[model samples]
Target chain A: MRKNRSPKPPEPCLLTECMQVIAGAWAPNVIWSLRAGPRRFNELKTDIPPVSSKVLSARLSELEERGVLVRHVRPTSPPSVEYELTALGEELIPALEAIVEVGHKLKQLRGYEPASEAAE
Target chain B: MRKNRSPKPPEPCLLTECMQVIAGAWAPNVIWSLRAGPRRFNELKTDIPPVSSKVLSARLSELEERGVLVRHVRPTSPPSVEYELTALGEELIPALEAIVEVGHKLKQLRGYEPASEAAE
Candidate 1:
């Protein structure tokens, strides 16, 4: 007699959702800068050069909505706002670190060095 | 007297490079499917529904060029080709796993269930 077997449950495509969070061109750079600490909008703009003010604001809002980052409004003559990573966002660091490791390995295999390093 | 201090060397942005590999919309899905084993072009297309033939072929070629996957051509009456992950590609699995874990947490926090589960 054949024993009955239950079909395996369909695993949700979690990686796809995660990738959506970081798919923005400047999302990783923004997250990387915030790893040091929280920053005001202007500070973030300064830290991540080449990103326009409009785009930066948009990405920040997107991250906040996704729960990856939090927006805190400070009470002052002019209310100051700062953005920082949430617990959920912090959880992404290890994965980012792993990606970095794999990326370095790929670069090494391809014999492609960063321009700054090449200049040095 | 101030002691001489060597400047910290600039670290390369490995995450950016890694992101380039998976930047394509279908990249993660393709990589995830390949995790099981090698597959032919047609097999991949079938596995990843909704992707057009042109886009799928481009993604395959791009992945192969990035050193993430290898394309093997088998000699037969009609040559058969299969694509499989390289060691570097295999290295990305852990990172992907981590991302998936974080994604699940995010989705749970949002109280959003997948459509399949919602149907049940």
Candidate 2:
């Protein structure tokens, strides 16, 4: 779900603030899952197998609080909940991909594992 | 000092570890400063004015411990020290810039302050 296009100019040296928010333990994974568009909580947990329900719920809440993701509730009989990226959250895709690119490269440099893309 | 060029493919769905490591309060700033090359502890503190000495020291140590940076000690008359990105650390530049790009866009969407680059 990560967006991989677009190479923009060097940003202000002060962007560490953005990094701090997205750097949370489950934030990146949540962002990546949302890249495919909005999904229900169970779908998200399915896509990202390791995150516990409580932790995922907490992370979703935190991302919403940080303006990174939006949570929606549908007025169904039992109530359905969905999570999606807000404009702010979608904007993070490129940056997160950039980090992934670096991770891929580091893996190559360390002779560890090649990036999923490179392996394919 | 954030690297702005090079847009590679989207990485595996599991790069949150790298983000977590660099997402510390002072870590991004430290990475930005180190992008130009190595610097002494005091120089880092000067470039990123908000961080305290203890925090900077702790962040640098944390980054070094995470394999993102290297600390070098010089046997100067007064004992000098320097910190630089390890290969892994240097590799983070593009990803960091990517995050900055997202931040810039978010600012645009939210009607918040523009990225430093656009302001310049």
Candidate 3:
């Protein structure tokens, strides 16, 4: 009896491990929005208009827990809060850019309307 | 009255669109497993041992529907079947590679065990 033990690419688990990092409702969006710089909670809302306050709040906390981002509290007249990517989080930008590139092609192939608002 | 409409990076939506492609249980694993070449159903199951047969089957169909892969049937004795990435699907490789790159860093920063089984 032979068990089919053919060689497997080692990336399955690694890819999955990373995928989990960006794997929540609007998690990728949050990261993409912050790629430029830090932003307040309301700024994130404007950046991703579709995300609800509840989901955004949860995703922000999760990202902080993962060390992908950090929250800074400014001692302003009213303690203003902002979120920014850690160095580790910055590493994800190239990955997200690659995804956006494919996204353009996928949109074309799938016959979806091109996003008129793409900043590029 | 000022409505904060600061210049926002436009990639948030694009990133979300692409993330949808790899968003599912073992979806990225299926793509990563097939990256080297085509494989049969059982081979995929073998490549990702933790994936259930049901989830694997479902992921295969979903990927097919997304045009990330193609299904081929061989007119062999028992009519064997294989699946492979299409050209568009091949485009996702670099994206996944970038993600894997970040995965390594992320694992390190989080002090998680280096994936002992990494193919390197």
Candidate 4:
């Protein structure tokens, strides 16, 4: 039998660490879905239709490990689980919004009138 | 033999697409390093010491593919290449800075005096 041992954690590089925390292939989609409110696993799966169940689960675990999202499991007849951003995660909104702002800028710079007045 | 066909590009989600462009393993480090000015490939490799040559190359290719970073080749005797962020990529700084700001806030909320006043 092979021993399943975790490799030593990489010494988190400052900037890369932050990006990795937010940059999972499906992470931004997960966070954006949660931005509306807390969600169940199924709800998130629906929000990101193309993500496979395995990929969604892995992304959630990664986000949870980074302390970006909280997972709550309720004790009941049947288990119910939900996920939401912690205060730290909520704080990331500005950064996400900033990215959107840049996208809007790029759009406008390409000669399209900005569609969203709120971005500026 | 397995064909070297590239995977179909993921349908770019709005926010996820932007994050993925900047969220590469060593991408932020490369961007931050370039923020000082343009840099050669060797300089970037040195800036991110922990990243393997293959990983760095892959990340560079991904960023270039996304049009975030530009790669230049010089036909000198020794051959030279340099990288710099396109205007759109440089525009991502505000978002990165916002993440650092949130980190500083998290640090303070955890009861350590914020070390950086510039964040606020």
Q: Which has the greatest lDDT? A: 3
- What is the Å distance of residue B72 in model 3 from its true position? 2.3
Q: What tens-digit string does per-residue lDDT give for candidate 4 at B12-57?
A: 3656656655766777777777765677777777667887889888
Model 2 chain B: which ten-residue window has the lowest total lDDT?
B1-10
Write the residue-wise lDDT of candidate 1 on B74-100 in tens digits.
996678788898777787777777777
The single-chain TM-score for chain B of candidate 4 is 0.71
Task: Give the clashing residue pairs of candidate 3, or none.
Answer: none
* lDDT per residue (tens digit) for residues B32-107 in model 2: 7788778887777767778999999889877876678889999988787989898778788887777676766665
Clashes of 4: 0
For candidate 1, write residues A5-101 as lDDT tens digits.
2221134367777777766767877777676667777777766667899899999987877777899999977787888987767767777777777
List the DockQ of the predictions in order: 0.31, 0.22, 0.44, 0.16
Runs of candidate 3 with Cα error greater than 4 angstroms are A1-7, A75-79, A111-120, B1-6, B75-79, B112-120
Residue ranges of candidate 1 with Cα displaced over 4 Å: A1-12, A75-79, A112-120, B1-12, B75-79, B112-120
Model 2, A2-107: lDDT tens per residue? 2312222244453866765575567788888788678778877766677899989888877876777888999987787988887778788888777777766765
Q: Please give the distance, in angstroms, between residue B17's alpha carbon in candidate 1 and its true position after superposition.
A: 1.7
Across residues B1-120, which tens digit of lDDT does each residue of candidate 3 receive? 346545688556677788777778888788888888888988888888999999998898878877788899999888878989877678788888888888887777666532223533
Candidate 3, Cα interface RMSD: 5.4
Best by DockQ: 3
CAPRI band of model 1?
acceptable
What does fnat come to for each candidate?
0.41, 0.39, 0.71, 0.28
Best prediction by TM-score: 3
